[model samples]
Target: TPIKRAWIWHYQRDDRKIFIKIGNILNLNPSVVSRNFNKLERQGSDPDFYAKTSISERPRLITPHAE
Candidate 1:
């Protein structure tokens, strides 16, 4: 679930937050992870639906590295 954990870590950041440097978090293959994270970020569901299926509802362990 490294990727899912990573997503949670990133999700905790507020949009008001901007970074000059993102640090080593991007150590993974960028192209693939970026694509997948985009998929998660794209879930523009209504608050009620999104609330029903919160981040905690995600598969507890997902190591979906494209490599």
Candidate 2:
């Protein structure tokens, strides 16, 4: 799926400190993309499969920056 690939691409990139405008590129809602990103984050925990979604531990790419 494009979403999964996009997420992997995100994970692979070193210059992904900022969030990608997936909504602008794919025309999907950012919320949906975020939800799936959370899912991907969980799935990243291979054997344990017990990934926790913490506000502090979330990937920087998905987190909103303070201005």
Candidate 3:
């Protein structure tokens, strides 16, 4: 659930507001990545696209490299 967790973690961050390119999270084709990002955009809970959590409410989804 890295993708989902990433969305939550990204949502929580307050200092840096950079868009988490789907390419960086998923290993799918560009089309799939774009599609997923777009899908989130269409939803009200679009974490990767719009970041849906406040700093106090964000969950931390650590990247693999860190572990």
Question: Best by lDDT, which number?
Answer: 2
Measured on C-alpha atoms, candidate 1 has an lDDT of 0.31
Clashing residue pairs in candidate 2, if any? Answer: none
Q: What is the TM-score of each candidate against the true structure?
A: 0.26, 0.34, 0.32
- What lDDT tens digits, residue by residue, belong to model 3 across residues 1-67? 3455335344533322223343444433444443344345344443333222234323232334443
Per-residue lDDT over 1-67 for candidate 1, one digit per residue giving the tens place of the 0 to 100 score: 1223433445444442211122124333333344344344554322211111124322222224332
- RMSD values for the candidates in order, in angstroms, are 10.9, 11.4, 12.1
Task: Estimate every model's Cα lDDT from 0 to 1.
Answer: 0.31, 0.39, 0.37
Instruction: Rank the candidate models, highest TM-score first.
Output: 2, 3, 1
Candidate 1, which segments miss by more than 4 Å at Cα? 1-27, 43-67
For model 1, the run of ten residues with the poorest summed lDDT = 45-54
- Candidates sorted on lDDT, descending: 2, 3, 1
TM-score of 3: 0.32
